[model samples]
Target: MTTLVYLETHDGELTNGGLGLLSKAASLGGGDVAGVVLGSGVRDAAASAGAFGASTVYVVEDEALAAPLPQPRVDALEAVVKESGAENVFLPASVLAADVAAGLAARLDAGLNWDLTDLRLEDGELVGLRPALGDTVLVDVGWTSTPRLALVRSGTFDPVESGGTAEVKEVAASFQEFSTQARLVDHLQEESSGPSIEDADVIVAGGRGLGGPDGFSICEELAAALGGAVAATRAVVDAGWYPYAAQVGQTGKTVSPRLYIALGISGAIQHKVGMQGSGTIVAVNKDPNAPIFDFADLGVVGDLTQIAPKLTELLRARK
Candidate 1:
Protein backbone atom coordinates (compact mmCIF):
# COMPACT_ATOMS: atom_id res chain seq x y z
CA MET A 1 0.00 0.00 0.00
CA THR A 2 1.17 3.51 -0.78
CA THR A 3 0.29 6.22 1.77
CA LEU A 4 0.09 9.95 1.12
CA VAL A 5 0.05 12.42 4.01
CA TYR A 6 -1.20 15.97 3.49
CA LEU A 7 1.50 18.15 5.04
CA GLU A 8 -0.15 21.37 6.18
CA THR A 9 2.03 24.44 6.54
CA HIS A 10 1.52 27.60 8.60
CA ASP A 11 3.75 30.68 8.51
CA GLY A 12 5.91 28.88 5.92
CA GLU A 13 6.56 25.95 8.26
CA LEU A 14 5.07 22.46 8.41
CA THR A 15 2.64 21.91 11.30
CA ASN A 16 3.59 19.45 14.01
CA GLY A 17 0.34 17.57 13.57
CA GLY A 18 1.10 16.94 9.88
CA LEU A 19 4.69 15.91 10.59
CA GLY A 20 3.49 13.62 13.37
CA LEU A 21 1.12 11.89 10.97
CA LEU A 22 3.92 11.50 8.43
CA SER A 23 6.11 9.94 11.08
CA LYS A 24 3.36 7.51 11.99
CA ALA A 25 2.83 6.52 8.35
CA ALA A 26 6.52 5.79 8.04
CA SER A 27 6.53 3.74 11.23
CA LEU A 28 3.67 1.61 9.95
CA GLY A 29 6.20 -0.09 7.65
CA GLY A 30 3.75 -1.38 5.06
CA GLY A 31 4.56 0.63 1.97
CA ASP A 32 6.11 3.76 0.52
CA VAL A 33 5.23 6.81 2.69
CA ALA A 34 5.00 10.15 0.89
CA GLY A 35 3.80 13.69 1.72
CA VAL A 36 1.98 16.29 -0.39
CA VAL A 37 2.54 20.00 0.23
CA LEU A 38 0.20 22.42 -1.51
CA GLY A 39 0.91 26.13 -1.28
CA SER A 40 2.87 28.92 -2.90
CA GLY A 41 6.61 29.02 -2.03
CA VAL A 42 6.43 25.89 0.10
CA ARG A 43 9.36 23.98 -1.44
CA ASP A 44 11.54 24.38 1.67
CA ALA A 45 8.75 23.20 3.95
CA ALA A 46 8.06 20.29 1.58
CA ALA A 47 11.68 19.18 1.69
CA SER A 48 11.68 19.38 5.49
CA ALA A 49 9.18 16.51 5.61
CA GLY A 50 12.13 14.19 4.98
CA ALA A 51 13.25 14.57 8.59
CA PHE A 52 9.90 13.16 9.71
CA GLY A 53 10.25 10.02 7.53
CA ALA A 54 8.59 10.88 4.22
CA SER A 55 10.52 9.11 1.51
CA THR A 56 8.89 11.13 -1.26
CA VAL A 57 7.52 14.69 -1.00
CA TYR A 58 5.18 15.95 -3.70
CA VAL A 59 5.17 19.70 -4.24
CA VAL A 60 2.29 21.59 -5.88
CA GLU A 61 3.36 25.18 -5.64
CA ASP A 62 0.97 27.55 -7.43
CA GLU A 63 -0.13 31.16 -7.07
CA ALA A 64 -3.72 30.00 -6.88
CA LEU A 65 -2.92 28.20 -3.62
CA ALA A 66 -1.39 31.28 -1.98
CA ALA A 67 -4.48 31.67 0.16
CA PRO A 68 -5.48 28.99 2.66
CA LEU A 69 -8.55 27.94 0.72
CA PRO A 70 -9.90 24.39 0.57
CA GLN A 71 -10.87 24.08 -3.10
CA PRO A 72 -7.44 24.83 -4.54
CA ARG A 73 -5.86 22.44 -2.07
CA VAL A 74 -8.34 19.76 -3.06
CA ASP A 75 -7.37 20.24 -6.68
CA ALA A 76 -3.64 20.03 -5.90
CA LEU A 77 -4.12 16.97 -3.71
CA GLU A 78 -6.18 15.22 -6.33
CA ALA A 79 -3.43 15.65 -8.92
CA VAL A 80 -0.86 14.26 -6.52
CA VAL A 81 -3.05 11.31 -5.54
CA LYS A 82 -3.52 10.37 -9.20
CA GLU A 83 0.16 10.81 -10.07
CA SER A 84 1.42 9.06 -6.91
CA GLY A 85 -1.21 6.30 -7.05
CA ALA A 86 -1.60 6.60 -3.30
CA GLU A 87 -4.05 4.07 -1.90
CA ASN A 88 -4.50 5.82 1.43
CA VAL A 89 -4.55 9.53 2.30
CA PHE A 90 -4.12 10.88 5.84
CA LEU A 91 -4.77 14.36 7.18
CA PRO A 92 -4.48 15.92 10.62
CA ALA A 93 -7.68 17.64 11.63
CA SER A 94 -7.67 21.44 11.26
CA VAL A 95 -10.16 24.02 10.05
CA LEU A 96 -8.76 24.11 6.53
CA ALA A 97 -7.72 20.48 6.47
CA ALA A 98 -11.20 19.28 7.42
CA ASP A 99 -12.69 21.13 4.46
CA VAL A 100 -10.02 19.93 2.06
CA ALA A 101 -10.34 16.34 3.19
CA ALA A 102 -14.10 16.36 2.62
CA GLY A 103 -13.72 17.93 -0.80
CA LEU A 104 -11.06 15.45 -1.86
CA ALA A 105 -13.12 12.53 -0.63
CA ALA A 106 -16.08 13.68 -2.65
CA ARG A 107 -13.96 14.28 -5.74
CA LEU A 108 -12.39 10.83 -5.54
CA ASP A 109 -15.57 9.00 -4.48
CA ALA A 110 -13.71 7.47 -1.53
CA GLY A 111 -14.70 6.47 1.98
CA LEU A 112 -13.55 8.77 4.75
CA ASN A 113 -13.17 7.86 8.43
CA TRP A 114 -13.05 10.90 10.66
CA ASP A 115 -12.12 11.60 14.29
CA LEU A 116 -9.81 8.59 14.38
CA THR A 117 -7.49 8.53 17.39
CA ASP A 118 -5.37 5.50 16.48
CA LEU A 119 -4.55 3.35 13.47
CA ARG A 120 -2.79 0.03 12.96
CA LEU A 121 -2.21 -2.62 10.34
CA GLU A 122 -3.82 -5.96 11.10
CA ASP A 123 -3.22 -8.82 8.69
CA GLY A 124 -2.15 -6.39 5.99
CA GLU A 125 -5.30 -4.25 6.37
CA LEU A 126 -5.47 -0.82 7.95
CA VAL A 127 -7.81 -0.33 10.93
CA GLY A 128 -8.79 2.95 12.48
CA LEU A 129 -9.80 3.41 16.13
CA ARG A 130 -12.66 5.82 16.83
CA PRO A 131 -14.13 6.88 20.16
CA ALA A 132 -17.83 6.17 20.70
CA LEU A 133 -20.45 6.48 23.40
CA GLY A 134 -19.00 9.77 24.62
CA ASP A 135 -15.47 8.33 24.42
CA THR A 136 -16.27 5.59 26.90
CA VAL A 137 -15.49 3.00 24.20
CA LEU A 138 -13.19 2.76 21.19
CA VAL A 139 -14.53 1.13 18.04
CA ASP A 140 -12.58 -0.11 15.03
CA VAL A 141 -13.31 1.52 11.66
CA GLY A 142 -12.11 0.80 8.12
CA TRP A 143 -12.78 1.79 4.53
CA THR A 144 -14.39 -0.59 2.08
CA SER A 145 -13.10 1.15 -1.04
CA THR A 146 -9.72 1.96 -2.48
CA PRO A 147 -8.04 5.33 -1.96
CA ARG A 148 -9.19 5.56 1.66
CA LEU A 149 -9.27 8.92 3.40
CA ALA A 150 -8.86 9.60 7.13
CA LEU A 151 -8.86 12.66 9.37
CA VAL A 152 -7.13 12.24 12.70
CA ARG A 153 -7.45 14.35 15.82
CA SER A 154 -4.77 16.91 16.64
CA GLY A 155 -1.89 16.06 19.03
CA THR A 156 -2.59 12.36 18.55
CA PHE A 157 1.04 11.57 17.67
CA ASP A 158 4.46 13.10 18.21
CA PRO A 159 6.84 13.67 15.30
CA VAL A 160 10.16 11.78 15.42
CA GLU A 161 13.18 12.77 13.35
CA SER A 162 14.43 9.78 11.34
CA GLY A 163 17.63 11.40 10.00
CA GLY A 164 16.65 10.56 6.43
CA THR A 165 16.21 12.51 3.20
CA ALA A 166 13.26 12.76 0.85
CA GLU A 167 12.98 12.82 -2.95
CA VAL A 168 11.10 15.99 -3.84
CA LYS A 169 8.78 15.59 -6.86
CA GLU A 170 6.99 18.56 -8.36
CA VAL A 171 3.41 18.17 -9.57
CA ALA A 172 1.73 20.37 -12.15
CA ALA A 173 -0.96 22.67 -10.74
CA SER A 174 -4.37 22.55 -12.43
CA PHE A 175 -7.43 24.03 -10.80
CA GLN A 176 -11.10 24.12 -11.77
CA GLU A 177 -12.38 27.62 -12.57
CA PHE A 178 -14.82 27.56 -9.68
CA SER A 179 -12.03 26.69 -7.23
CA THR A 180 -10.28 30.01 -7.80
CA GLN A 181 -13.35 32.23 -7.63
CA ALA A 182 -12.97 32.87 -3.89
CA ARG A 183 -10.48 35.51 -2.84
CA LEU A 184 -8.97 36.05 0.61
CA VAL A 185 -9.76 39.54 1.93
CA ASP A 186 -8.23 39.66 5.39
CA HIS A 187 -6.28 37.22 7.52
CA LEU A 188 -6.00 37.89 11.22
CA GLN A 189 -3.63 35.99 13.49
CA GLU A 190 -4.64 35.52 17.08
CA GLU A 191 -2.41 37.45 19.47
CA SER A 192 -1.05 35.09 22.10
CA SER A 193 2.07 35.25 24.25
CA GLY A 194 2.58 31.56 25.03
CA PRO A 195 2.29 28.42 22.96
CA SER A 196 -1.16 27.29 21.86
CA ILE A 197 -2.83 24.63 23.98
CA GLU A 198 -2.48 22.09 21.16
CA ASP A 199 1.31 22.52 21.02
CA ALA A 200 2.06 23.19 24.68
CA ASP A 201 3.86 20.53 26.68
CA VAL A 202 1.92 21.55 29.76
CA ILE A 203 -1.60 23.00 30.11
CA VAL A 204 -3.49 24.47 33.05
CA ALA A 205 -7.26 24.41 32.42
CA GLY A 206 -9.98 26.30 34.33
CA GLY A 207 -13.62 25.34 34.79
CA ARG A 208 -16.92 26.65 36.25
CA GLY A 209 -15.68 25.96 39.76
CA LEU A 210 -13.45 29.01 39.31
CA GLY A 211 -16.66 30.91 40.31
CA GLY A 212 -16.45 33.51 37.49
CA PRO A 213 -14.33 34.97 34.73
CA ASP A 214 -12.09 36.73 37.26
CA GLY A 215 -11.16 33.39 38.83
CA PHE A 216 -9.14 32.48 35.73
CA SER A 217 -6.42 34.83 36.97
CA ILE A 218 -5.09 32.06 39.21
CA CYS A 219 -4.96 29.67 36.28
CA GLU A 220 -3.15 32.20 34.16
CA GLU A 221 -0.60 32.93 36.89
CA LEU A 222 0.07 29.25 37.50
CA ALA A 223 0.30 28.50 33.81
CA ALA A 224 2.71 31.38 33.28
CA ALA A 225 4.86 30.27 36.19
CA LEU A 226 5.05 26.77 34.77
CA GLY A 227 5.78 28.04 31.24
CA GLY A 228 2.58 26.41 30.00
CA ALA A 229 -0.61 27.54 28.27
CA VAL A 230 -3.99 28.25 29.81
CA ALA A 231 -7.08 26.29 28.78
CA ALA A 232 -10.76 26.23 29.77
CA THR A 233 -13.79 23.96 29.91
CA ARG A 234 -16.91 24.17 27.74
CA ALA A 235 -18.89 25.55 30.68
CA VAL A 236 -16.53 28.47 31.12
CA VAL A 237 -16.46 29.24 27.39
CA ASP A 238 -20.26 28.92 27.09
CA ALA A 239 -20.72 31.25 30.05
CA GLY A 240 -18.50 33.86 28.34
CA TRP A 241 -15.88 33.44 31.06
CA TYR A 242 -13.21 32.34 28.56
CA PRO A 243 -12.48 32.36 24.86
CA TYR A 244 -13.86 29.52 22.81
CA ALA A 245 -10.39 28.75 21.43
CA ALA A 246 -9.21 27.82 24.94
CA GLN A 247 -12.07 25.41 25.52
CA VAL A 248 -11.39 21.63 25.61
CA GLY A 249 -14.22 19.17 25.21
CA GLN A 250 -15.98 16.87 22.72
CA THR A 251 -17.19 19.83 20.70
CA GLY A 252 -13.81 21.56 21.02
CA LYS A 253 -10.26 20.52 20.21
CA THR A 254 -8.51 17.40 21.52
CA VAL A 255 -5.09 17.74 23.14
CA SER A 256 -2.43 15.39 24.50
CA PRO A 257 0.09 17.38 26.50
CA ARG A 258 2.83 15.99 28.72
CA LEU A 259 1.28 17.43 31.86
CA TYR A 260 -2.34 18.61 32.35
CA ILE A 261 -3.41 20.48 35.48
CA ALA A 262 -7.14 20.85 36.10
CA LEU A 263 -8.23 23.68 38.39
CA GLY A 264 -11.80 23.60 39.67
CA ILE A 265 -12.85 21.17 36.89
CA SER A 266 -15.65 18.70 37.46
CA GLY A 267 -14.37 16.31 34.74
CA ALA A 268 -17.53 15.71 32.78
CA ILE A 269 -17.37 12.92 30.19
CA GLN A 270 -17.42 15.56 27.45
CA HIS A 271 -14.34 17.23 28.93
CA LYS A 272 -12.52 14.00 29.82
CA VAL A 273 -12.58 12.82 26.20
CA GLY A 274 -10.53 15.82 25.13
CA MET A 275 -7.51 15.48 27.44
CA GLN A 276 -7.57 11.80 28.38
CA GLY A 277 -4.38 11.29 26.39
CA SER A 278 -2.29 13.54 28.66
CA GLY A 279 0.80 11.91 30.14
CA THR A 280 0.16 13.10 33.69
CA ILE A 281 -3.14 14.52 34.97
CA VAL A 282 -3.49 16.48 38.21
CA ALA A 283 -6.75 17.80 39.54
CA VAL A 284 -7.38 20.38 42.29
CA ASN A 285 -10.95 20.88 43.42
CA LYS A 286 -12.90 21.57 46.61
CA ASP A 287 -15.14 18.54 46.23
CA PRO A 288 -13.49 15.34 47.42
CA ASN A 289 -15.77 13.21 45.27
CA ALA A 290 -15.35 15.23 42.11
CA PRO A 291 -15.27 13.04 39.00
CA ILE A 292 -11.86 14.48 38.08
CA PHE A 293 -10.29 12.65 41.01
CA ASP A 294 -11.32 9.28 39.56
CA PHE A 295 -8.61 9.36 36.87
CA ALA A 296 -6.18 12.04 38.01
CA ASP A 297 -2.63 11.00 38.74
CA LEU A 298 -2.71 13.31 41.74
CA GLY A 299 -5.81 14.74 43.42
CA VAL A 300 -5.82 17.61 45.86
CA VAL A 301 -9.01 18.46 47.71
CA GLY A 302 -8.71 22.16 48.48
CA ASP A 303 -9.82 25.61 47.48
CA LEU A 304 -8.18 26.56 44.16
CA THR A 305 -8.30 30.23 45.11
CA GLN A 306 -5.94 29.52 48.01
CA ILE A 307 -3.92 26.59 46.63
CA ALA A 308 -3.30 27.90 43.10
CA PRO A 309 -1.72 31.11 44.29
CA LYS A 310 0.62 29.21 46.63
CA LEU A 311 1.51 26.75 43.89
CA THR A 312 2.22 29.59 41.49
CA GLU A 313 4.46 31.27 44.04
CA LEU A 314 6.34 28.05 44.73
CA LEU A 315 6.85 27.40 41.04
CA ARG A 316 8.13 30.94 40.45
CA ALA A 317 10.44 30.71 43.45
CA ARG A 318 11.88 27.41 42.18
CA LYS A 319 12.53 29.00 38.81
Candidate 2:
Protein backbone atom coordinates (compact mmCIF):
# COMPACT_ATOMS: atom_id res chain seq x y z
CA MET A 1 0.00 0.00 0.00
CA THR A 2 1.14 3.53 -0.65
CA THR A 3 0.35 6.64 1.38
CA LEU A 4 1.11 9.70 -0.72
CA VAL A 5 1.02 13.36 0.34
CA TYR A 6 1.05 15.99 -2.41
CA LEU A 7 3.11 19.08 -1.54
CA GLU A 8 2.93 22.78 -2.48
CA THR A 9 5.20 25.82 -2.23
CA HIS A 10 4.94 29.26 -0.69
CA ASP A 11 6.88 31.97 -2.49
CA GLY A 12 8.63 29.10 -4.40
CA GLU A 13 9.87 27.61 -1.16
CA LEU A 14 8.44 24.31 0.15
CA THR A 15 5.38 24.85 2.34
CA ASN A 16 5.44 23.68 5.94
CA GLY A 17 1.70 22.93 5.69
CA GLY A 18 2.50 20.16 3.21
CA LEU A 19 5.20 18.88 5.55
CA GLY A 20 2.72 18.83 8.43
CA LEU A 21 0.20 16.98 6.27
CA LEU A 22 2.88 14.45 5.41
CA SER A 23 3.49 14.01 9.11
CA LYS A 24 -0.16 13.01 9.52
CA ALA A 25 0.02 10.80 6.47
CA ALA A 26 2.90 8.90 8.07
CA SER A 27 0.63 7.63 10.82
CA LEU A 28 -2.40 6.68 8.70
CA GLY A 29 -0.18 5.39 5.92
CA GLY A 30 0.12 1.64 6.53
CA GLY A 31 2.88 0.82 4.10
CA ASP A 32 5.32 2.83 2.00
CA VAL A 33 5.00 6.61 2.33
CA ALA A 34 5.36 8.51 -0.94
CA GLY A 35 5.97 12.24 -0.99
CA VAL A 36 4.97 13.50 -4.44
CA VAL A 37 7.01 16.56 -5.35
CA LEU A 38 6.09 18.91 -8.18
CA GLY A 39 7.64 22.09 -9.52
CA SER A 40 11.08 23.70 -10.04
CA GLY A 41 13.18 22.04 -7.34
CA VAL A 42 11.63 18.57 -7.60
CA ARG A 43 14.95 16.80 -7.26
CA ASP A 44 16.25 18.90 -4.37
CA ALA A 45 13.05 18.70 -2.30
CA ALA A 46 13.72 15.12 -1.28
CA ALA A 47 15.44 16.04 1.97
CA SER A 48 12.37 17.83 3.26
CA ALA A 49 10.14 14.76 2.79
CA GLY A 50 12.41 12.78 5.09
CA ALA A 51 12.10 15.44 7.71
CA PHE A 52 8.32 15.04 7.51
CA GLY A 53 8.28 11.20 7.41
CA ALA A 54 8.16 10.28 3.74
CA SER A 55 10.64 7.53 2.90
CA THR A 56 10.03 7.42 -0.84
CA VAL A 57 10.05 10.77 -2.61
CA TYR A 58 8.60 10.84 -6.12
CA VAL A 59 9.61 13.86 -8.17
CA VAL A 60 7.89 15.37 -11.20
CA GLU A 61 9.60 18.47 -12.60
CA ASP A 62 7.65 20.66 -14.99
CA GLU A 63 7.22 24.38 -15.51
CA ALA A 64 3.43 24.08 -15.33
CA LEU A 65 3.76 23.29 -11.63
CA ALA A 66 5.40 26.68 -11.03
CA ALA A 67 1.89 27.96 -10.38
CA PRO A 68 -0.42 26.13 -7.96
CA LEU A 69 -2.92 25.10 -10.59
CA PRO A 70 -5.15 22.05 -10.17
CA GLN A 71 -4.52 20.56 -13.60
CA PRO A 72 -0.79 20.21 -13.17
CA ARG A 73 -1.04 18.76 -9.69
CA VAL A 74 -3.86 16.50 -10.87
CA ASP A 75 -1.74 15.29 -13.78
CA ALA A 76 1.38 14.80 -11.65
CA LEU A 77 -0.42 13.08 -8.78
CA GLU A 78 -2.23 10.76 -11.19
CA ALA A 79 1.15 9.68 -12.47
CA VAL A 80 2.09 8.64 -8.95
CA VAL A 81 -1.23 6.83 -8.56
CA LYS A 82 -0.52 4.79 -11.65
CA GLU A 83 2.97 3.74 -10.64
CA SER A 84 2.42 3.04 -6.98
CA GLY A 85 -0.12 0.64 -5.49
CA ALA A 86 -1.03 3.36 -3.02
CA GLU A 87 -4.25 2.72 -1.15
CA ASN A 88 -4.47 6.25 0.19
CA VAL A 89 -3.57 9.76 -1.02
CA PHE A 90 -3.28 12.96 1.03
CA LEU A 91 -2.90 16.63 0.17
CA PRO A 92 -2.81 19.92 2.06
CA ALA A 93 -5.98 22.04 2.49
CA SER A 94 -5.13 24.95 0.27
CA VAL A 95 -7.04 26.30 -2.70
CA LEU A 96 -4.89 24.26 -5.06
CA ALA A 97 -4.65 21.06 -3.05
CA ALA A 98 -8.40 20.80 -2.50
CA ASP A 99 -9.11 21.29 -6.17
CA VAL A 100 -6.54 18.72 -7.20
CA ALA A 101 -7.59 16.14 -4.63
CA ALA A 102 -11.17 16.20 -5.87
CA GLY A 103 -10.16 16.23 -9.52
CA LEU A 104 -7.65 13.44 -9.02
CA ALA A 105 -10.30 11.37 -7.34
CA ALA A 106 -12.62 11.77 -10.29
CA ARG A 107 -9.87 10.83 -12.69
CA LEU A 108 -8.75 7.78 -10.69
CA ASP A 109 -12.29 6.47 -10.18
CA ALA A 110 -11.87 6.91 -6.44
CA GLY A 111 -13.46 8.89 -3.59
CA LEU A 112 -12.20 11.90 -1.66
CA ASN A 113 -12.53 13.39 1.85
CA TRP A 114 -11.72 17.08 2.15
CA ASP A 115 -10.27 19.08 5.05
CA LEU A 116 -10.01 16.16 7.46
CA THR A 117 -9.49 17.25 11.07
CA ASP A 118 -8.68 13.80 12.40
CA LEU A 119 -7.52 10.44 11.02
CA ARG A 120 -7.15 6.98 12.44
CA LEU A 121 -6.94 3.31 11.56
CA GLU A 122 -9.98 1.36 12.56
CA ASP A 123 -10.41 -2.37 12.26
CA GLY A 124 -7.74 -2.31 9.59
CA GLU A 125 -9.57 0.40 7.68
CA LEU A 126 -8.58 4.04 7.22
CA VAL A 127 -10.81 6.48 9.10
CA GLY A 128 -11.12 10.21 8.53
CA LEU A 129 -12.50 12.88 10.87
CA ARG A 130 -13.59 16.32 9.73
CA PRO A 131 -15.71 19.26 10.85
CA ALA A 132 -18.97 20.17 9.20
CA LEU A 133 -21.26 23.21 9.63
CA GLY A 134 -18.33 25.56 10.18
CA ASP A 135 -16.67 23.21 12.69
CA THR A 136 -19.51 23.26 15.18
CA VAL A 137 -19.78 19.49 14.67
CA LEU A 138 -17.53 16.77 13.29
CA VAL A 139 -18.63 14.09 10.84
CA ASP A 140 -17.02 10.75 10.27
CA VAL A 141 -15.77 10.38 6.74
CA GLY A 142 -18.52 9.06 4.52
CA TRP A 143 -16.41 7.74 1.68
CA THR A 144 -14.45 4.50 1.82
CA SER A 145 -12.76 3.05 -1.20
CA THR A 146 -9.47 1.89 -2.63
CA PRO A 147 -6.77 4.57 -2.78
CA ARG A 148 -8.82 6.77 -0.47
CA LEU A 149 -8.15 10.45 -1.02
CA ALA A 150 -8.01 12.80 1.96
CA LEU A 151 -7.51 16.57 2.05
CA VAL A 152 -5.84 17.54 5.31
CA ARG A 153 -6.46 20.92 6.87
CA SER A 154 -3.18 22.74 7.43
CA GLY A 155 -1.85 22.84 11.03
CA THR A 156 -4.16 20.08 12.26
CA PHE A 157 -1.53 17.35 12.43
CA ASP A 158 2.02 16.37 13.36
CA PRO A 159 4.08 14.08 11.08
CA VAL A 160 6.31 11.25 12.28
CA GLU A 161 9.60 10.06 10.77
CA SER A 162 9.07 8.54 7.30
CA GLY A 163 11.42 6.10 8.98
CA GLY A 164 14.44 5.40 6.71
CA THR A 165 16.83 6.51 4.02
CA ALA A 166 15.22 8.81 1.50
CA GLU A 167 14.48 7.17 -1.82
CA VAL A 168 14.38 9.61 -4.73
CA LYS A 169 12.43 8.52 -7.78
CA GLU A 170 11.71 10.67 -10.77
CA VAL A 171 8.64 10.06 -12.91
CA ALA A 172 7.13 11.32 -16.17
CA ALA A 173 4.28 13.59 -15.11
CA SER A 174 2.89 16.18 -17.50
CA PHE A 175 0.56 19.15 -17.52
CA GLN A 176 0.94 19.79 -21.23
CA GLU A 177 -2.75 20.30 -21.93
CA PHE A 178 -2.98 23.33 -19.71
CA SER A 179 -0.08 25.02 -21.47
CA THR A 180 -2.03 25.28 -24.72
CA GLN A 181 -4.93 27.36 -23.43
CA ALA A 182 -2.98 29.23 -20.76
CA ARG A 183 -0.65 32.00 -21.73
CA LEU A 184 2.88 32.04 -20.33
CA VAL A 185 2.35 35.18 -18.30
CA ASP A 186 5.34 36.76 -16.67
CA HIS A 187 5.77 35.97 -12.99
CA LEU A 188 7.68 37.78 -10.27
CA GLN A 189 8.96 36.20 -7.09
CA GLU A 190 8.80 38.24 -3.92
CA GLU A 191 11.90 38.24 -1.76
CA SER A 192 11.07 37.83 1.93
CA SER A 193 12.91 40.49 3.92
CA GLY A 194 13.43 38.55 7.12
CA PRO A 195 12.86 35.04 8.41
CA SER A 196 9.55 33.84 6.96
CA ILE A 197 6.88 32.92 9.50
CA GLU A 198 7.51 29.29 8.60
CA ASP A 199 11.19 29.79 9.37
CA ALA A 200 10.77 32.15 12.31
CA ASP A 201 11.69 31.03 15.80
CA VAL A 202 8.77 33.11 17.05
CA ILE A 203 5.57 34.37 15.43
CA VAL A 204 3.13 37.07 16.55
CA ALA A 205 -0.30 36.52 14.96
CA GLY A 206 -3.15 38.99 15.08
CA GLY A 207 -6.84 38.52 14.46
CA ARG A 208 -9.98 40.59 13.74
CA GLY A 209 -9.85 42.44 17.04
CA LEU A 210 -6.62 44.07 15.93
CA GLY A 211 -9.33 46.12 14.13
CA GLY A 212 -7.88 46.16 10.61
CA PRO A 213 -4.75 46.11 8.49
CA ASP A 214 -3.44 48.92 10.67
CA GLY A 215 -3.58 46.64 13.69
CA PHE A 216 -0.81 44.43 12.32
CA SER A 217 1.70 47.22 12.72
CA ILE A 218 1.38 46.66 16.42
CA CYS A 219 2.15 43.01 15.86
CA GLU A 220 4.95 44.06 13.54
CA GLU A 221 6.43 46.22 16.22
CA LEU A 222 6.34 43.41 18.76
CA ALA A 223 7.63 40.84 16.29
CA ALA A 224 10.44 43.11 15.24
CA ALA A 225 11.46 43.69 18.81
CA LEU A 226 11.48 39.96 19.51
CA GLY A 227 13.19 39.16 16.19
CA GLY A 228 10.24 37.10 14.95
CA ALA A 229 7.79 37.07 12.08
CA VAL A 230 4.24 38.40 12.05
CA ALA A 231 1.29 36.14 11.17
CA ALA A 232 -2.52 36.37 11.18
CA THR A 233 -5.56 34.23 11.77
CA ARG A 234 -8.06 33.38 9.03
CA ALA A 235 -10.43 36.12 10.22
CA VAL A 236 -7.73 38.66 9.44
CA VAL A 237 -7.00 37.01 6.12
CA ASP A 238 -10.69 36.79 5.19
CA ALA A 239 -11.13 40.37 6.29
CA GLY A 240 -8.30 41.36 3.95
CA TRP A 241 -6.54 42.82 6.91
CA TYR A 242 -3.34 41.05 5.91
CA PRO A 243 -1.89 39.33 2.86
CA TYR A 244 -3.07 35.78 2.20
CA ALA A 245 0.56 34.70 2.52
CA ALA A 246 0.65 35.62 6.22
CA GLN A 247 -2.55 33.82 7.26
CA VAL A 248 -2.28 30.90 9.67
CA GLY A 249 -5.21 28.54 10.24
CA GLN A 250 -7.04 25.51 8.80
CA THR A 251 -7.13 27.06 5.35
CA GLY A 252 -3.83 28.87 5.57
CA LYS A 253 -0.22 27.93 6.38
CA THR A 254 1.19 25.66 9.08
CA VAL A 255 4.02 26.78 11.34
CA SER A 256 5.91 25.07 14.17
CA PRO A 257 7.76 28.13 15.27
CA ARG A 258 9.04 28.17 18.87
CA LEU A 259 6.61 30.83 20.03
CA TYR A 260 3.14 31.67 18.61
CA ILE A 261 1.39 34.81 19.82
CA ALA A 262 -2.30 35.29 19.12
CA LEU A 263 -3.84 38.70 19.65
CA GLY A 264 -7.61 39.26 19.56
CA ILE A 265 -8.45 35.91 17.99
CA SER A 266 -11.30 33.99 19.60
CA GLY A 267 -9.55 30.71 18.70
CA ALA A 268 -12.14 29.07 16.52
CA ILE A 269 -11.68 25.30 16.35
CA GLN A 270 -10.43 25.53 12.79
CA HIS A 271 -7.91 28.17 13.79
CA LYS A 272 -6.81 26.33 16.91
CA VAL A 273 -6.38 23.11 14.91
CA GLY A 274 -3.51 24.82 13.12
CA MET A 275 -1.37 26.51 15.76
CA GLN A 276 -2.01 24.41 18.85
CA GLY A 277 1.25 22.59 18.24
CA SER A 278 3.45 25.60 18.89
CA GLY A 279 5.96 25.31 21.73
CA THR A 280 4.79 28.44 23.47
CA ILE A 281 1.45 30.23 23.08
CA VAL A 282 0.53 33.65 24.43
CA ALA A 283 -2.84 35.26 23.73
CA VAL A 284 -4.11 38.78 24.15
CA ASN A 285 -7.85 39.05 23.74
CA LYS A 286 -10.49 41.17 25.43
CA ASP A 287 -12.89 38.26 25.98
CA PRO A 288 -11.70 36.27 28.94
CA ASN A 289 -13.70 33.26 27.75
CA ALA A 290 -12.29 33.26 24.21
CA PRO A 291 -11.38 29.75 23.02
CA ILE A 292 -7.88 30.93 22.13
CA PHE A 293 -7.21 31.20 25.80
CA ASP A 294 -8.00 27.53 26.32
CA PHE A 295 -5.05 26.47 24.19
CA ALA A 296 -2.86 29.38 25.11
CA ASP A 297 -0.13 28.79 27.63
CA LEU A 298 -0.52 32.32 28.86
CA GLY A 299 -3.69 34.29 28.46
CA VAL A 300 -4.31 37.93 29.21
CA VAL A 301 -7.83 39.27 29.06
CA GLY A 302 -7.59 42.84 27.75
CA ASP A 303 -8.19 44.94 24.71
CA LEU A 304 -5.53 44.41 22.02
CA THR A 305 -6.28 47.85 20.62
CA GLN A 306 -5.23 49.43 23.87
CA ILE A 307 -2.52 46.87 24.76
CA ALA A 308 -0.81 46.49 21.39
CA PRO A 309 0.61 49.99 21.32
CA LYS A 310 1.68 49.70 24.90
CA LEU A 311 3.31 46.34 24.17
CA THR A 312 5.04 47.84 21.19
CA GLU A 313 6.27 50.73 23.29
CA LEU A 314 7.48 48.36 25.96
CA LEU A 315 9.39 46.36 23.38
CA ARG A 316 10.87 49.56 21.94
CA ALA A 317 12.06 50.60 25.36
CA ARG A 318 13.66 47.19 25.94
CA LYS A 319 15.82 47.72 22.90
Q: Write down the TM-score of every candidate.
A: 0.96, 0.82
Residue pairs with backbone atoms closer than 3 Å in model 2 (clashes):
23-159, 53-162, 87-147
CA lDDT of every candidate = 0.93, 0.79
List candidate 1 segments past 4 Å from native: none
Q: Choose the strongest candidate by lDDT.
A: 1
Residue-level lDDT of model 1, residues 1-319, one tens digit each, is 8999999998899999999999999999989999999999999999999999999999999999999999999999999999999999999998899999999999999999998888899999999999888888999999999799999987788899998999999999789999999999999878888889999999999999899999999999999998899999999999999999998878787888899999999999999988988999999999999999999999999999999999999998898
Report how far off residue 254 is in candidate 2 (Å).
Answer: 5.1
Residue 6: error of model 1 in Å? 0.5
Query: How would you encode candidate 2's per-residue C-alpha lDDT over 93-179 as one tens digit per residue?
Result: 777777888888888989888878778877767888987876678888855578789887765655455446668788888665653
Alpha-carbon RMSD, each predicted model = 1.3, 3.2
User: In order, how many clashes per candidate?
Assistant: 0, 3
| Candidate 1 weakest lDDT stretch, 10 residues | 247-256
